[model samples]
Target: MTIRFPVLIALILALSAVGLTYEIAAGRVLAPFFGTSLLTWTTVIATVLGGFSLGSALGGIVAERPRAVALRNVRSALVATAVLMAVSPTLLGLLHSWGVRGTDGMMLSVILVFFPASVCVTLPSPLLAKLAIEARPGREGSSLGFVLAAGSVGAIFGAILAGFVTLPLIGSTATFAACGVAVLLCLPFVRGGQTGTPGTTIAAAVFVVFAGLAGTPACQYESGLSCLHVDRQGPEVRLVSDGTMQAAESTAPGEASDDGTVGLALSYTEWFWARMDRDLGPDPSVLFVGGGGYTLPTKLLASRPLAEAVAVEIDPLVTKVVRAHMPRAAEMIARTGFDAAEGDGAGRRLGIFHADGRVYLNETEQRFDAAVMDAFSSGSVPAHLVTREAFARLREIVEGPVYVNLLDRPDGPLARGVHAILRELYPHVEVVHGARTSTGRTNVLFAASRLPLAPLDSLPDRYSPARISDARAFTDDRGWVGHR
Candidate 1:
């Protein structure tokens, strides 16, 4: 059986799309456990590229075979690709449950779950190219060029569709299954792949459907920024973003404060508000760099009722998830008329702007009495948001002390680096933590101000001052990237 040039090129494009979709979705799937750090992305890219190179080598060997065998093997390879793509999510879950974590675990997970699928997806490309060449005999250079261009262009489409469309629309698990289905669909259109039995393809399709159905979804809502989910622990409702608990509040009777009022759940927010209470007046206008679950912003509006606050949350989906799932936060947003669409036009009590914190800071002319740098990507502050240049601009906009929340090992480089940068700009810079031991990762807060700050010795044995003596500062040119 002879394959048409157009049909063969279409197959190449579609398969390339599925392969790149798998690559992009791999990052999202690993994010919940591994925290989409620089290391995670680096590992995923390396593993995928290694697998593709190996598969292309194997495909070259298959291309040397008789046409019938080569085409038959391509069909079998596509079937394998479909199976692997569909089952990868479950495989990742199993690996994670077995205590797979850290750099080693991340590397292992990517190699085991994604690498084989990458290999299978590209294994048929050489064989398809051979068919394309045969269809147009002496136009070898043009045929190869078309194949190469189609594959590259298809990858671009897959990346855009996965990042902006499928992953956000249907979620990571479903997206993985869809990629498998996409590869399987290409099997029917391949003209020369004369497989005697359709039994394997049918079996693989059934298995992909079963795996998709049986797999538990990791997130309630997935956005380009983070995986959003809600969890209930007793009466406390917690909002998790990218496996990090962003916000929590008690809902049960008598679980509120002694005054019958609900307050902040996370300890860092309490520290932020404590500083705000000491420095700012009741009607103080505050700027929040990151609005995770909008917890602090909601609390500010509830307590002051008319406190003008703007929360620049990067992901609108995060705010949407909080409004739908977390009742307490939702009530405060509705009460304050905090519509993201209004964009500072209507509600001054609480304005919600969806944008990168640093970009918003650069663009806005509005000034505030104080600022809270509560924004984070996974466990660490986004590199640009933590740099010396970023803080220099922030100090200009915010009149009083600027509070920053970070997660790092006790006196880790990230903490020390950020502290070093802050010291260069502010007259008074201090690092404090609630943890007792100088070990492991803990929430470290940096309070930098033009004016002298009072000792944060309020809570029992909390806010222990950390010394920052010798450390390199993070700048826009040399930004912090990895998890410490």
Candidate 2:
């Protein structure tokens, strides 16, 4: 009896770990469709937790009669969850197929797919706990603690495994599938003594069909491919491929850019390079936070005097694409004898660090003269990168002026947000309008520095539009102001 209790406790812990892993995996699975945003992640987690809470409560009520009944309920819940987990992606895809794309679509999809699935999976926990206590009433506290500890350990493993193995190996969809399979494997163990209930079996089978249907691939729209992610406002679509966002476009069919650059278009590359040139000058030591297509790096090599360049991109797939597509940039680095190696001189002129930009910046002792924040897009600025706290950290590593690319509309809410942030961080800040296009609003560049900038009129001819005339000064308290 003692051995059985301990074993059951261990199984419960494993199941909890599986639950947590599936929640995270679900986020990644939805990233391609929704883009990994704070709201999206929050929705995923909240739905899972809510589902877990609902399931556990319901399971407790249903299992009140006997240990056998409780165990049966738990097993049924687990199986149902696995099946729902498998089917969610397909449902989201179907929603997309019906021309239902955008933030509202994504939020609704998550609620539909993730909420019930998580709730169903959550049913086992309370019942399992009750059973554990029933089996060994005297050691209830110890058993509960052990189960929780096991769950904590499993959660740690799940996070590590997702990062190192699942995501890198199988892609997001496959990772979710693998997690669903793990939960299904636990069903037989949890249902050890329980006879198959007809109603439970029917529900489980239905979920299985749903999962299979969800996993089936459907025809994805060409334009849809460009706006890889749908943000909540539902009107704006951020273009992403292989995890990294390339650009953003409107969702309205006619509202989108007819130009090639509208969806994953390379013209944004030229525009980005031009902005970099405008601010950083021809020759500048640059630190690029996110390497989208390595388009900017390639252009910098040709147009600017890049004394030293460092590209920190989180996604390996993006780096691979950059290497493949932007051969010239790679060749430049190779010729300059710049490699990933750490040291001084020409051999160390360029380095590509495949790590989180915030992590890399935090850890590196090296500083750059020009830190270009070109990574902002799709109404998402890595919270860490945009915060006043992060600006302070960047101030420590960067000696020269910092250039931030603002993708918000000239006077939109996003632009206001950027303006507010810049005001808090830098004493001297100015916004420069980049190329305007008919396809979308123009991109704006915000130049910030601790040092006082020359008056707008004093800037040379190269500083066209005159930073003073075109620029709006921002105060930490007042936000963007036309006059000082």
The C-alpha RMSD in Å for every predicted model, in order, reads 2.0, 8.1
Residue 145's C-alpha lDDT in candidate 2? Answer: 84
- In candidate 1, what are the lDDT values of residues 66-157, reduced to their tens digit? 87888888888999999999989889989999988777888999999999999999999998888888889889999999999999999999
Q: Which candidate leads the pack in TM-score?
A: 1
Point out where model 2 deviates above 4 Å: 1-3, 66-69, 191-194, 197-272, 275-283, 304-306, 325-345, 362-367, 376-379, 392-401, 420-442, 448-484
Clashing pairs in 1: none
- What tens-digit string does per-residue lDDT give for candidate 2 at 280-391? 6556777888765554554455455445688777665554544444344446545553435354444455567767777887898887877777663233555556655566
lDDT by candidate, in order shown: 0.83, 0.60
Q: Each prediction's TM-score against the native?
A: 0.95, 0.73
Worst 10 residues of 1 by lDDT: 339-348
